[model samples]
Target: MLKITHNTISEYLSNRTFSSIEKIQKENNNKKYLLLLSFLLLLFIVVQFLPWTQNIQAKGEIVSRFPDQGPQTVQTIIGGRIEKWYVKEGDQIKKGDTLVFLSEVKSEYFDPNLIQRTQEQLNAKDLSIGAYENKVSAIENQARALEQALIIKKNQTQNKLVQAKNKIEIENAELQNINKNNQIAQNQYQRIRSLYQKGLKTLSELQEKELKYQETLAKVSIQQNKLNNAQNEYYNLELELSAIERDYSEKIAKANSDKQSALSQSLEGRAESAKLRSSVSNYSQRQKMYYVTAPQDGYVSSLISTGIGQTLKEGEEIARIVPDKNNIVAQFKLSPQDIPLVSKEGKVRMRFDGWPSLVISGWPETSTGVFEGHVIAIDQFLTSDGYYRVLVQPNDKYKPWPIELRMGTGTQGFFLLKTVPVWYEIWRQLNGFPADYYREDSPETKKK
Candidate 1:
């Protein structure tokens, strides 16, 4: 066991066993080689200490910041060949702008598997609706009959009420006649009584007068009873009229309820039929209005399946539309290794293709016409290409990109990662290091 002090190591290197190394050094220590070697070492050390903000450069494009409902993909309504193109790509169009026309297609002439099946189904549905129409008509007729019967019953009730009034009036007249005869008999009895007392009238005559008065009184009592009976019968007739009214009302209500149920059923059938009819009508109209129109005001961003004579199947995509100006965003793609370094704090330097600009790495002062942007968000997952899609917005501190900046223009982004010793990043990249700049415990990771 031995402890090798610094002096001991130096002395060992100076020994004759290391004399071969010493000799080689002495022979090759020419002034030019020594000078060149010293200069390279100095340069490497200086570069390692220089302020190097890691800049991740990725080729990207200027993309529109379309709203949730902005961009749309137009598709063909039927299987047909393109007859003509009314507008080309990059054309600014208003809503309902004609883009391309498709040739006419019908079930009889052009019967694809899907189109033929759909047409047959529509025909079957139309036929099925006839039964519902019959049901509706039958229900309506029943309702009408009930309504007419109710009217007739009401008229009969009114007639009965009038008859009861007439009977009451006749009975009242008979009662008055009986009352007049009773008064006349009372007067005759008085006169006869006076004469008999004077012996000028016979006893039989007086008795006869008394009997006549009694008969008249009896007739009055009988007639009064008849009047009371007639009045009771009149009330009873009124009750009958009320009962008839209630009975008819219930019948009419029931009939109306049944009719409504039938009508609702009919309407349900008709609603579905209307939907199918509209679909068929739209297809027919589309045959004449063959041109596919834009759903919104926008520029024709791109055309994929649109050309004269190109066949388009039903619902096949034709082109992509970029909605109106004002919403613009820059999309920068970054490698997984650079993901940890890209966040809200990261800076973006973009050069829109049409806008002439030069990005001077690490020297922002020398950059020319470059649009400055900031990282708004970074996708949580890598795309199919193993790159993260980073959303960028124009930096408020610097000048914004021109309003004329078009979507899908070529762009070069300089995503400024954290500033570190230039040598640290160089060494990490050389060794194929993973992203480790942002820690899980940091605010950035927690926020995400």
Candidate 2:
């Protein structure tokens, strides 16, 4: 039952009118403020269209400059105390050169045969074992020569005996001729004497015939004695020659027999020495297992030894060498999201962090141009920062640009992601969608 008087009505209309005016004024002010905000927003959008406004990717050098060069470590063929180092660090070496020396622990690492033979010699306690072997070999050669000489000597002795017999026969023939002449002379003398006695010839003729017969008789006797002496001398010479030759033959035979026996002894000694040497070598080799050696050439980076001369357990990493240049691998990490785009054959560009604008083409330094390379592997484990690692093998055909371009050059890098179209960027802005949406579908289609 509230009364509605004429004044109340009038005042209420006034209040309504006043309130409508305030509302109208607020709306006008708000419209102007909104227009100003729109102007500022448009100005911002226009600025992005200017050429200077764009996001660039990252760039830098590799892990370091001047990668370390080291020689491959040569290990002991059979391990033992580092008996000695033949070449110290920084020493130049040739192929097949012995860089390190290892003294045998117990005289066993020599040739097995050599060691065994040495042991045999030791057992015999004979310093002459080696000398005996040489003597035997020399004697064997001498025996062969002597045998040949003995054969020739025997032939010569037989020839001398035959010549002596021929000389005796000739002397006997000469004596027989003289006896026949003497007989003829005697007959003539006797006939002449008988004629004289019958008075058919003079006394002078008989005397001359007797004188000639006497002279012929004397000549016959002298020739007979000469023949006898020649026969005796020939026989004596033959006997003496036979005796001398027999003595020589016996001496030569004895010498050859002695030589053979000595040679046999020498051969036995050699065989025994060889056996002992082998045993010593085997023992030396068995002891070698306790020793350790470098696998490749490198700088020793770490040593896990308890002290300078402490013994290490088997399989222990007593020391480590920073591997040589060939073993250097460029390691890098990227987010898991980037892994799918990367593969074993993916191409990548690299820059060292320390040296800006310098990209190492996987090529080696010996090449004329930047090297081409391919991805070799990806680490299965992720880093603490949730990044997976990758390994790239430089091309072998070309040398790398320089050590300045290799790993540990402190180089930082970036991989260029595929770019998006200009229209896609504009469309994304119009729809208020995420920038990534443009990667899958056009902004226009996504909005639809």
Candidate 3:
């Protein structure tokens, strides 16, 4: 129990009162500081709600339209050494115009019947014993080969006969004309000779007419000789072709007889050779298909420096042809960050490389010296140069298009993403950020 004085009590109460008042003042100052800090934070957050524009910048070039199949890369269908070139660079050509010719390559035709025939002969070899098996089989193969050879030769000779006859017909027409001219010259020479004798024409004139008559006669004989030669060729080919056919038939019959004998003997060798003449004929026609022709009406823009005698692989590009049609696509490159913002439906604003980049950084709506475009597509992956690819088409919505547009011209594209509050963008920039969420959501909802 401490004794209490009235004055001491009053002094102690005064001191305690002073202490309480100081503590209250300190607490109020702390509250004021906290209130000021909170107000500043609120101001920063509210500022993020202001409007801002965001866009992706990219560089690219104008390219042929995808619908036109783009610029064509003409390639060879068959692999062979180039034999001839029909079109030069910059030459306009129609569809089916031959551009390149390749050397003809030999091809073998499949024949099942010949194989069966050979097998029959080989089976027949079994009865002759082991010593003659190889010999018999070889002979059978040789006979089969010879048979095919004779058939091919007969066909070739027949073709030759037809060609020779056609030549003879042509020569006969020429010979008829030559004979008429010769008769005219002879008549003229007789008249000149009579005139010379009657003293109406000089000896020099008569001699000249005689020489003309002889020359015409010589021409007639020459024409007749050509016709006779053609006729002789036709006759010889016809005879040779007949002989080959007869020999081929006999050999085939003998081979069949031998095979019948060998079936009892029971030895065989397999020969897979041409039994179908259709395949052979088709291959012969294809041999002429070594020439590469233009797929459509186009102009030869360029060709490989490799010329005649240079071997090209199948599907190898020999030249490039630009079609007469016009369809243009602006091709451009994007960065990895810009890829997500671009969509097929999204719009693009392009400033051609030659065209000024009249692009104001923040406000694309007020863009000048730029053209409107619609996004076409985005590439599956980045290019080798670490840039992504994006295709866009000209919108031409704002005004009439510029006249200087062309393929392969460089372009700078502004890939517009979305509109968001400037305040939100600043806040996002301060931290890490997601895409503009304000524009992604509805206006009323965002406001709420």
- The 0-to-1 C-alpha lDDT of every candidate, in the order given, reads 0.78, 0.56, 0.75
Q: How far is candidate 3 from the true structure (C-alpha RMSD, Å)?
A: 30.5
Candidate 2 positional error at 71, Å: 18
Residue-wise lDDT of candidate 3 within 107-218, one digit each (tens)?
3323424434544544444334454455557668867887889878888998898899899999999999999999999999999999899999999999999999999999
TM-score of each: 0.46, 0.35, 0.44
Clashes of 3: 13
Error of 1 at 392 (Å): 4.0
**Residue 84, candidate 1: alpha-carbon lDDT:** 83
lDDT of 1 by residue, 1-448 (tens): 4666545566446645677877776777776688999999999999898766667788887776656335678888778888888778899998998888887555553543444465666777667677766776776787788778878877887787788788889889998998999999989998999999999899999999999999999999999988888888889878987887788778878877776776777677677777777767665665555678988888898898866788888899998887785567788888877777777857888787777676677666578988788888789998998999998888879987888877677888888765667788788789988435765678987988
Poorly placed runs, candidate 1 (over 4 Å): 1-45, 56-74, 78-99, 102-288, 293-313, 317-337, 349-373, 382-387, 393-414, 422-448
Please list the residue runs of candidate 3 whose C-alpha ends up more than 4 Å from where it truly belongs after superposition.
Answer: 1-52, 64-68, 79-83, 103-278, 309-316, 380-387, 396-407, 419-448
Looking at model 1, report the run of 10 residues with the lowest lDDT sum.
107-116
